[model samples]
Structure formats: C-alpha cells, structure tokens
Target: MTVSRARLALGALILVAATAVLTYAATVNVYVQRLETRLDAFGEVADHPVFRRLLDVIGYVRRFYVEEVPLDQLLEGAVDGVLQSLDDPYTVYYDAEAYESFEISLTGEYEGIGVVVTTVDEYVVVQTPFPGSPGATTYPDNHDGVSPPGLRAGDRILEVDGVSVVGMPVERAASLIRGPRGTTVRLTVERPVEGAPPQVLYFTIRRQSIEIPTVQQADMVTPRIGYLWLTQFTPDTPGQVREALKRLRDQGARAIILDLRNNPGGDLSASVQVASQFVPAGPVVHVERRGGERETYSARGGGLGLPLVVLVNGGTASASEIVAGAIQDYGSGTLLGEQTFGKGSVQTVYTWEDRQGRAAVKVTTARYLTPKERSIHAVGLTPDVEVPGTPEQQGDPQRDPQLRRAIELLEQRLGG
Candidate 1:
C-alpha cells in the first residue's frame, strides 16, 4: 500500500509540471503571434536600415542582457523610440501623469496654481492668470490691495517650491507647478531683466476648484462704457458671458468693449455659442479639413445690440482666433490691437495605453478658417489697428496700448 501511494504522488507531481510548462508555452506563442502581426503592419519597412537597426538592438537587449527586464517597460521604450523618429514636437507619447493632465486640460477644469503658462526662450512664462486665482490675489497685492503690486507681464519663472526648473522639460515643469486645489507653491521669478538673479518670492496659495473664469466684466468708464474680457470659450463660458452682460447692463453701459487678447481658445462649440451672442443669423467661421473638406459655423441667436468693439493681440490663438476671425469676417465688431496668435489647427486627444495610469496623444486633425476661408495658422488675423512691441520697445505694457486703442475706438463709435 505504501509503494502504490508513492507512485501516485510522483505521477501527480509530473502532471503539474507538465501543465505549467504548457501554459507558459501558450503565453509565449500568443506574444509571438501578436509581434508577428505588428511586424506585418510595417511590411514596407522590412528593408529599411533604421528599422533593421532597431530590431537588432531590441534582440540584443533581450538575449544578452545580464539583468531581468520588465516586458511592459521595454515595449514602452520601443514605442517612444518609434515616435522620436517622426521628428515632430507635437507628436510625442504622454506618460500616465501627462495623460491625466491632458485630459483635465481638455475638459477645461483642473486644480492648479491657476496660471496659464507657455515656453518662451527655454523658460516658462505666465500667459494669464485666472481671476480669483491664488497668484492673482496673492502676489499682485499692492499696499492698498486695490491694484497690482508691480508683478507685470513677461515674468520668467526660475523655480517652483524652491526647486530649480532649469533642466526640466517645460511640460514636466508645468505639471509640477500644478496640483490639487488648496496646495501652495512658492516661485522665484526673474522680472525680465537684462541680467539679474531671480527674486525670491513666496506665495502660500490655496488651491480651489478652478472653474476657469473665462470671462471678466468691469465698467470701463462707469455708466458710459463697459469692458468684457473673454479669456477662452470654455464649457461654462456662455453662462459666464450672460452673467457678465447682465451685470454690465445693470451698470448702465451704453457701449461695450470685448477683449479677446491672448486667448488660446477652447471648445469649438463654445466659440459658436459665444459668437452667436453678437451677430444675427450668419456664418461666422469655417473649418477646413485635409483633402479640401470644409464645414461652416454660424450664429443663430441674438444678444446685446450695443456699440461693440473686439480687442485682439498677437497672443490670441486657436479658438480665440476663431472668435476674432468670425467677428472680423461678419462685421459684427471692430477688431483692435495687434494681429492674433495664429494656431488654426484643431487637435484631438486620445489615450494610447492603459497602465497604472493613462497616457495620451494629441494629433492635429483639421485647420480652422474664417467665413471667407482665410487661413489663421501661420497667417494670423490682422487687426484693423496694430500694436507693435518686441519686449524691449514696449517693455511690460505689451497689450495696454492695444487696450487703450480698443477703448478709444468703442468710445468714439458711441459718440461718447
């Protein structure tokens, strides 16, 4: 009886080993088949020298490497290698954190320092600060608390939370600066000086929901004229504009100044919604895709029919350009200030991988044009009046002259 039991135990052990080996073999086969399919998709590149070199490197690492390699990391590295070969700054892979940020940015809702930033000459510069933003109420506090405390435009950020941003990529640096609402971030900034070390500035900012104050309203001259600054056409933009209009009307504003300066843009639908408020039923702007395909966007509603003037500048890009271009094309309002920031291409972001977090890619899908089919990409929308400044000439008052010009134009049209 003991001998029979031992034989059965040995047989069971052998069966278990066999099953394990078969399962591993099946998994390997499946991976191999998928790899083969991917290679087939690159059929035409079989003879390419660069392609062959990549394959050789991958094989060498897999076979002769001394340390164990994680398959997912290896695959990600390979994918990055492929994208790098494209040589396009706009075409690159987004890791998990970047993907999350990209998603939030598209929705136009995120918790951060509440500052829009852009890379300018190897340094990140503040584009605009949303109203009620931590930085807005914090750093620009004068002795009276009624005006700005000397922080001006074109300020270059040197550090965040005392960490140097020198060697970091602009995108990475931006991500670091942004965090959940209520978080505080101190910054060291160089005030666009000819040669000076960054000034040590501290800001204990409380992060809030950051609903993106797309529009701001003020009685420009009180009871006579008012100003409405539309930073972007976000999801909540229409309601904000409506609210501002109501406030402006309450203040007895006779003429209106609509500021679209430095607006980078937002949802296309939002642009249409905002534009609809100004013009009668008319086509505002047109969208042109690759291969000569086109579509037109028009206004369908009525709005405040006061003497109106729209302000624009060279930093007005994308959906901002759409609104400016539309107003200019339809003759709904006079465009003052400098020509717009030309970013006519529309992009679509999609998640490319599923891992611990999501990563995405934003691809330019189409080009936006005016109702007259005027290109607004490299060809910026020229304002009726131009404001010239090159940082050195105009200094910190880059858009002030332009704003003055718009206000003047609106006041004149209203016979004020």
Candidate 2:
C-alpha cells in the first residue's frame, strides 16, 4: 500500500486542480466576451445624433476620400468631432495648447494679461483679474484713483492688439492676450458706462510675474476692526488666512471683516480648510450628486473667537461660495455684498482605455451644497446685506462698496 498508491493519489489531486483552473479561465473569458459585446451594443444605441453624423463623415473618409488616414489622426478627428457635435460652449476639446494652459491654471500661474475673460451672451466680458495684475489696473480713472487707463474688473475686452474678439472663440481670445512676461499686449476694452459705445481704449500693459495674493489686510476706520480680503481659495490660502488672522489679532483687532468680493474661487480642499478655521467641530459643506452619493467636509478643531463678517459679491464662486455659505449657515459670520457666481458643480478628470486607446475625460461628477444641504448651482448664494457696485466703482477694497459695508458692519459689531 506504499509507493504506487501514493503516486495515484497525487496524480488524482493534480488532475482535479488543473481541471478547476481551466474552468475558471474559461469562465473569465466568457464573462469578458459578454461584457465587450454588451458595451458595443450600448455604444451603438447611445450614439448621439452628432456622433452618428461624425460616423457618416468617417465612412466618407474611409470610402471616397483620397489617402488612407492615420489611425492617430482618425482618433483625434473623432474626438474633436464628438465635442463639436455638442454645440455647448462649455463642453470643449482641448488640444495640447489649451490643455497646457489649463495645467498652468491649476498651479495658479500663467503668462497672460492676468485676466480671466469669457463670452457672456455674445459679448467678451472680463472675469475676475488676479490682484496686482494688468487687468486689475485697467479701469476708469474715476474708480479707486489708480491712474493711467487700465482694464477694470468688469470691463468688456472688445479687441486684443486691434484684433476684434467678436465671433471669436473665448480660448482664442484668451490665447491672443496671454504670452511671456515683459511682453506688451494691447487691449481695446469697453467700459461699462451708461450710454457709452464699446470704446477702443488701448492698454499697452507689460506683463509681470503675477503672484496672486490670497489674503489682504487693512485697518478700518474703527481702529479695533481688522479687515481681511480673501480673493480665492488657493492651495496655501488657509495658511495665508491663518497668518493674516494672527497679524490681525496682534494688531488688537476685535472684529474681523472677511472680504470675498469678485473671487472666482480655486481648490475645494482649501475652502474647507479656511472654513474649518471658523466653524466648530461640525459639517462645513456637504458635497452630493443627483444619484444620492454624498461626502461631508467637517471643521477640524478650534474656532476663531471674534465677531466674524464675510463679504461676498457676484464673482464669489465654487469654493468661495462654500466658505461663505458655511460661515453664514452656521451663524459664525454675517454675509454682505451681492449674490455669488454660483458654480457649484464638482468635476473629476479621468483617463480610460477605449477602442481608440486612452483618452482624458473631464465630467461633472458631483454638486456642492451648504452645511444645511442647500444647493447653489444655478441659483447663486445671496448675502445678508446686498450692496452692488456701480460701473464707476470697480477694483478692490476701495472699488467694492460691499466690502466697505462689511467693514462698517464689523465696526458696528465692535461698538465703534
């Protein structure tokens, strides 16, 4: 019962294991084939009308066109064709150049006139300009007393170096104005005045190293009130604010005026970090989607012990809204200024392998909400005290009447 019996048992065990492994491999192959088949079927069914038209064009190229199109060329054409079909201005295909600009934007550095410009209802309008940049200086002489004709925060950029921006894509317009530092870019902008035609005002600005100041500090008329201006929620914005708060505290500031006027916003995590400095250990902002997925950002630890006043305006967007909304909802601060910009959607950038290999896709993945679960997507966040700036007034601290009101409110809180 020794050697032959043992060899037979071992052979039987090996045979069983090999059979199981083969079965598993077969099962996996079948599952993968089925999945691929289903995906192909779904893709055909979900082919948008535009995509179908693109497919028609591709068919024409494959059949009637002269030369054989390279596979890479065909893929790029297909990608561009897909985005063009949408007809939505926001939905766009970024070539290497535009994608590079986007990358620079994320790092908060770009070689431009330091202006964020976009088309709003067929007119090129100036979005928020980075502090100390050319755009901030380009304004009317009446506003803030910053001399020499410069573009204001809300001015319309009609032409770039005499090139008419009308009927041009925003990306093209942006590209035309943005270039290397020390280079001069002339902008023919339209000042928003009553009964004034789109004037040809030239701004020959030499671009410089535009380091965006996340936090600005000033002493109000009430000596006890220290005003802190938070432009955007950048990566180091929380630390900047903490340092500002410390300086304000050291200056014997009893009431704090947090100004968030015309801030188009930045990093979401930075907003949560800034908000965490104000609120107690509780939910600061809750991010949710249409499908019931949820994520809650909570305050870290201690709280700023002072009469807090948050100032917001039309440009206050995304993460700025998050901070402002949280402060207002928790009774931690009083909000002043105009309604916010209301860009509350969260996006995720992903690259996936398809039939054409890997392609980058950025899709709106989630919607943001206040601590009380109030969605501020299209509907902007309204302030407690509404103060709108006139066309004559457009800059910082001084140009914003709303910020002044915030200072006044903080002073009042300090019994000044």
Candidate 3:
C-alpha cells in the first residue's frame, strides 16, 4: 500500500467521527430547545434570568476550565447552587446514596448507633442518645479515660472513623455513622458544658438495629393520672397512642399528661392522625400554600375526651407543634412547660431517578397554621403556663420544674 492511500483512509475516518459528534450535539440542542418551548407555554421560565446565568456558568466551565471535571459532579453542583439560592433551610438536595438512606430513616428504624442528631451551624450535634444504647451508657469506672465514651445531648460530632464530618449534610454524617449490626464505628465528639470548658470525647461504638419509638413511654404516673411521653411522630404513632390510651384506661386512669418535650416531629399524616386521638374531630391544622391555596387537616374519629396536659419545650417541633397547637386551640388540653420549637413549614419530599442514580429534594411547599390560624414558623407555641428548665432533671420534682408544674396542674384538675 502507498503512504497517500493510508493518509486518505485516516482522513475519511476523522471526517466520519467529526460528523457523528456534530450530529449528537445538534440533537441535544434540538431537545433543549423543545424543553424551553414547553416551559414558555406555562410561565415563560425560559426567559428567566436564572436560566441565562446557569447556561453562562455551564458554558464557561466547559470551554475555559483548566482541570477536567466529571459531568455529573458539575451538574450536581449547579443543582445544589440553585436550591441553596432559595434561602430556605427546609429545601434540600440529596444525592443518590444520601436519598436512599434518608428514605430508610423515615421508617423509624435503622442500623446505627442509637442517637437523634441535628446540624447546628457546621456541626452535627447529638439531640439525645436512646436509653440503654451504647451512646447512653458511660463507663462505670474510667481508669483509661473519661467523658468521651457516652455521647451526650448537645455533643457535636466532628469526625466519624476519623474522617471529618464538619459542614456536611446531617444525612451524610448519619450515613457515615450507620452500618450493619455488629460493625464498629469510631467517633470524635465535642461536648459542651455550661459555664465550663467543653469536653472532647472519643467513642468506638458497635452498630445495632436502632428502632426509634413514637411513644417512648406510657404508664400511670399517678393512680388515676397517666403520663405519656412521645419522642416523635410516625406512621405507627396513632396506633401506639390508641394502645397507650387503652392501657391507661385499663389501668383505671381518668386524667392524662401527654409529654412532647424533645419530640422533633415526623410524618405529617401521622401527626394529624395522632392529633385525632386527643383533639376530637375538628380542624387540626390549616396548610397555606403559595398563590393563597389552603388545605385543612381535620381530626378523624372520636378522641378520648380525657382531661389533658400537654408538656412541650424548645425541642418540640413540626408535627409535634401541630398536635400541641390543635389541643390548645380546641381547649382539649392545657399546654405546660417551655415554649415549643417553631418549625411549622410543611416540607414535601420529591424523589427522582436518572441515568446516574436516584436523587431527591425536600421542598417547603407550604406553611402550616394551627387550628386557631396561627403560623408558628420561628415563633414557637407559648405554653399556657410557661415553666423553664433543662432535660437533665427529667424525673425529679425539684429538678424538672416543668414536670413538677404539670403534676400540680393535673392534681388541681383532678381535685376540682
């Protein structure tokens, strides 16, 4: 063969490849244009400034970037930026792995160290460790080291297995902490103390199947007065409440004390159902959406009609607020203890899958108002009788003034 013949074949190959590339680009352009046309039919979103800014960003990165970046990462960063610009903390973007783990968490069970955690600023802080879990048990005799074995409330988790988790999503940090039962995970935590230097603790905890209960405890605090402590709301909550009420009733109880202190809230539907068990059949909450659309979630079925006192604090949030707000508005229960945690925005979780994997977004689609038509977002519910105290003195009368006051009020109601 000749050099010219080889050169000609190479030129033809290059031409075909170039043609294929141009054709693919054209097809993508056509698809994007069609999408823009569709978007225009609804709200002229294609002409929006955000669309222009985003396209400019993509073009600049693709054409003039020095280092190569994966398309997925680049696109995901863009998606994250857009969501962040909404300036709403409730609206969040979760990647595939994080989203999968998040869905599991909603079921009220998982394989991990049993602790409720939340992100405060740049740290993932422990709300509380479940009773009887390793996180709750401190070393009886600390000859080796001290103050690090047992995780405490308000402890900021800085590292998981020595990898820094600071400034990351709560779900991401949680995923790092979770694993199959019998596996071990090391943690570096910063424990804050009042009027003293903070303590940094190290923990090597074995993972276990952690099942979080909706109703943490239910029993007769007095011979005829029942105390029900709820940790969170879930699908199983209403049933658990029913069972608890039955048990309390069988135990010969007439009055009740419902505790929502430190309850961080959960499923909205479950919250409404749980409210139904206490608030009687009436409007429990009103959801107000953009464009002035409103939805009323009413209590279903007959309530227990027992004289009630609902104990709440700053830890009480979201769905917990819904129940407390309704009970207060209907005069079905007297709210005591500290002010409630004001988290009244109703978030709607939307999940989708692409060629890459699954992703999800939790968007604040509406604001939830109490039955009395009060929005509690950041304003919290003021107790009928405000009493201030810490959770450290949970069961003691003198220590937990809130509990002491609740008892006093219930006694008065019973006495009357």
Candidate 4:
C-alpha cells in the first residue's frame, strides 16, 4: 500500500476508537445523572454535602484518572467508608464472602477441616481439633489414605496454600481454610516438640461440612457436681444443654458448673433458652431499642432447680453475657471468674444483594439489659467470686485455679 493511504487508514482507526470511548463515557454519565435525580426525589440525600462530594469525586476519577476505574469497586469503597465513619466497631459491612460465612455460622455448620484456632504471640495457633473432623484424625504418625492426618492442637499455622499467614489473625486464617466441601486446602504447619527443635509439616486437607458443637465438654466433675462447658450459643445449643442436664441428673448430680470461659457468644434465642434451663419462670433479659423501647424475654418453667455456678472470663461476651447476667441477677447461680467482655449491644444482621452478589450489614439495633435492668455495656459484669485466668493454666485442669475454685465451691455446697 502507498504510504499516504496507510497513514489515512491508521488515522481512521484512531478516530473510531476515540469516538467509541467518548460514547461510552457519555452513556455512563447519563446513567449516573438519572440515578442521582431519582434518588434526589426521595429526600435530601442527593443534596447532602457528603453525597454530592462522593458523586463529584467518583465522576472526576472516571473522567480524568490515569487508568480506568471500576464502578463496582468505587461503590463498595463508598459503602465501606460510610460504615467506618460510624465509629461503631460492632456495626460492620460484610462483602459477599464474609456474608456467606456469617450465614454459615448461624446455621452452626460450614465446609472446613474443623479446627478452632486463635491468635497467640502473632501466630495462628490451633486451639482444638473437632472430634471426627479431618483435623482430629490428622496426626504425624497416622497415615490413613481416606482421611489423612489433620491439624493438631498447638500447631502454628505458617502458610495457607503457599501464602504466609505467620502474623495473620485466626479469623482470617480460618476463612482461608474453609471452602466448598470436597475442595482441598494445603497448609504448612510448625509443631513444637518437647526438648527438640520445632518440626515443620505439610498437609492437604479436604474440606467437609462440619457441625460445630456448642456444648464442648459435659461430664461429672465430682460425684455430685456436673460440669457443662458451653462453647458458644448455636441453634442446637438448647437441645444439647437440655440433654446434658438430663444425663447429669440421671447420674445423681445435684449441682452444676456452667463454664463460659473464652466463649464468644452466638444466637440470642439460644442464650435465652440456655438461661431458662436453670432460672425459674421470669424475665431472663430485656432488649431496649432506640427511643426507649424495650422487649422482655421470659424464662419458661421447668428449670432443673439444681444449685449452679457459672465460670466466665474476659472472652465471655454478647449472648453469653445475657445468660450469665440472667443467672446472676435472678440469684439462680453463682458467677466465678474475672469481669465479662461487656458487649451489651444487640446486633441485627441485615442481608441484601446488589451487582456484587450478596452482602450484609450488621447494625447495632438495641442495647440489652439483664432482668435486673443492668446494662453491662462498656463495664462488664463483676463475678460474685473473682478469679483470674492465666495463660499457663489453659489446658491443665489441675493447674486451672479457677476450675479448682469452682469445684471447691460446689463441694462446699454439696457438703462433700
């Protein structure tokens, strides 16, 4: 082709591309303008300074930015910024992944290897492996073909699928480990051995639908005292507690020790049910909404009528606090431990969807109070018998001063 003809063709191509870009930009601007007008019809939202400024900034970025910006990302950032500005830690916006996990948590089930972890010394450490879970079967020596060795308690999670999680929070690490059932997640773990260097190990675990048990350990601590360690309040917690109580009663238990240590609370309804098991028929907790609205949760009759003592610590929060507070206020049980975590605000999870699939907004809807009308918001509940928890006495019940004290108290009550 002639040089002049070639130059003309290239100029035509450039013009067509520029025209297409301009047309697309105009279309987007028109769409946004229409949306703004429609939203303005609702109220003062469109005229609000913050809303106007956000739109202006977004428009500017779309027009003059060095690179193309995704509208979805900008919208998500705006949502996040608004939530952050509220300054309420409990009020949060959950993206698609987080929302899905939240729903799974409510159901008391999820697809994971079934290992409960905690952040300790800047490392994600396995606190416990659920029995029959892949983690429970995973051991250094056991080499089964079907369910290979899984995670062990005290194992330091170093990496997940080649990504370093050395200083990652346990929650984040747990989310990464959880996936659709039958999928595999590779983990690099470091296990400390007694009087030897730490051992590095690798494992590929297939995730499965794990049913989280709310009642962790239930047994007779003594001849007449039963110990029920409530892990967290879940949908099945009430049934589990009821069954445990029946078994304990059948075994000739006259007293009970309800352990709520390190338990981050869950379902509110479950908490009420558990508290009702020990307290007489009356108001267990009161939920007070904004503008002074209040709702009372009354306990149903049929309490075990057994002398009870509750164990709590700084980690006892939310729904757990509801149970502990009710028990304390009603004088149904003796509380023994440090002050509670003091999360007295009630959150209602609102789920919705947009172009970004599913999302959730967990907003603080009300402030709950004990039957005695005590709002333990920032100030936690002070135990009747104050006992401190120490890191050294974590696993060893013999060294657990708090447990020993509880047993002692129960023994005295039983005159044993």
Q: Cα deviation of 21 in candidate 1 (Å)?
A: 47
The global C-alpha lDDT for each of the candidates, from Candidate 1 onward, is: 0.61, 0.64, 0.72, 0.71
RMSD of 2: 13.1
Candidate 3 or 1, higher lDDT: 3
What are the per-residue Cα lDDT tens digits for candidate 3 across 261-280? 77778778888888898877
Each candidate structure's TM-score, on Cα atoms with residue i matched to residue i, is 0.69, 0.74, 0.77, 0.69
**lDDT for position 215 in model 4:** 83
What is the alpha-carbon lDDT of model 1 when measured against the actual structure? Answer: 0.61
Query: Which candidate should be chosen as best, given lDDT against the real structure?
Result: 3
C-alpha RMSD between model 4 and the true structure: 11.8
Where is model 4 more than 4 Å wrong at Cα? 1-41, 111-174, 177-210, 390-399
Each prediction's RMSD to truth: 11.7, 13.1, 9.8, 11.8
Poorest lDDT segment (10 consecutive residues) of candidate 4: 18-27
lDDT tens per residue, model 4, 1-416: 45743443333222111111000001122334334444454354434566556666766876799999976676656665665565555555667876666555556578888776655566887755655677655454324444235565567899999999875534456788888898988888887777999878887887889986788888887789888888778778899999998899899899998988766677788888888998889998998888999989999966658888898876677788899999999898999988877778877655545565865566677888999999998778999999864423332357668878888998888884
Ranking by lDDT: 3, 4, 2, 1
Worst 10 residues of 1 by lDDT: 18-27
